[model samples]
Target chain A: DVKVTQSSRYLVKRTGEKVFLECVQDMDHENMFWYRQDPGLGLRLIYFSYDVKMKEKGDIPEGYSVSREKKERFSLILESASTNQTSMYLCASSLTGSIEQFFGPGTRLTVL
Target chain B: SQQGEEDPQALSIQEGENATMNCSYKTSINNLQWYRQNSGRGLVHLILIRSNEREKHSGRLRVTLDTSKKSSSLLITASRAADTASYFCATDRGGYQKVTFGTGTKLQVIP
Candidate 1:
């Protein structure tokens, strides 16, 4: 089975703090994504990386940014965390041209 | 902007009963995918139907796509409690590696 692991299952941070969420995939997939799921809003893509050092902004990328320095690792960064930034963040990865994405367990971040 | 919209935001059914969810998209797509998410967890891909295909099946799950109508439907036969989850429909637009997800339909199977 494909394994995707997140650095933290839960996190708490104060306003204006910088927060980082990490994701790693064992499948060597070429595509990786970051999403934040809100109630009634489903899962909204924050950012995605097609390959190492390549990044693209998704629909809701204003408050978030991402990094993919290596193929297996993807990281989401919050420049200045706010209470509104609290949400369940998910990381997913898929092979090139594949529609099925394997996802990590998710990190529930609380910005207080 | 969101591309897909799923109908019947929430559903409840008795075990063994069939459950169906509908998704409608706004633009052209290369493919449509169904994903299931257990409470407080990540999503699991259930099925994917290419734009050219009309229908596909995997075990007890059946998926139908109507590209002309920009819509799709997913049906689960002999539903079990384990099938309880939030189902989401995602659309993959041809290039730029863009994919959009719908709000989702929450299904509850009573055993």
Candidate 2:
């Protein structure tokens, strides 16, 4: 089974605080992605990594960054949490060049 | 800019009825996929239709794609209360596996 796990289901942060969201997938897939879901706006990709140490910016990568130091783990970093960055964050992984992505449960972050 | 746009931002239906949703994109795609997400949960992949294929089915779910029109539709037959969730359409524009997702359609199935 493809299992994707996130470090937290819910997180609260104060403005200007740095935040780190961790995701680990057991599928050993070559591609990993980070996305944020907002009400009415749906899910927008923040960043993705095709291989270890490789990353690409997605549609909404302004306030976020990502890391893939290992094949099974991916991390999303918020330089400084802001109210506008409060949303449901999701992580996903897929086999090389495959379209079907397995997703993690998600982390709901609240910034105040 | 080229993203899938799902029609009917919200829908309400009774259990055992059929619900259909449409999606339109602005560019050519290698494949189109449908997914369901329960409130506060991750998305569940439902189906995928290739650009060369016109239609595909998975149990109670049916998906149709029109590459010429850059549109697709997902139909759920005999929907149940468990089917109440948000549905999204994603398009793979055929290169490095970058997929763009649509806003989504919120479905409410009253049992």
Judging by DockQ against the true structure, name the best candidate: 2
Top candidate when judged by lDDT against the true structure: 1
lDDT of 1 by residue, A1-112 (tens): 9999999999999999999999999999999999999998989999999999999988889988888999999999999999999999999999887778899999999999
Error of model 2, residue A14, in angstroms: 0.3
> For model 2, what is the error of residue A112's alpha carbon versus the real structure, in angstroms, after optimal superposition?
0.5
Q: Taking the candidates in order, what DockQ does each have?
A: 0.73, 0.76
The stretch of ten residues in a row with the least summed lDDT in candidate 1 chain B is B92-101
TM-score of chain B of 1: 0.97
Worst 10 residues of 1 chain A by lDDT: A94-103
Give all candidates' CA lDDT scores.
0.94, 0.93
Q: What is the C-alpha RMSD of each candidate to the true structure, in Å?
A: 0.9, 0.9
Q: Model 1 off-target regions past 4 Å?
A: none
Residue-level lDDT tens digits of model 1 in B16-72? 999999999998999999999999999999999999999999999999999889999
Query: Please, what is the TM-score per model?
Result: 0.98, 0.98
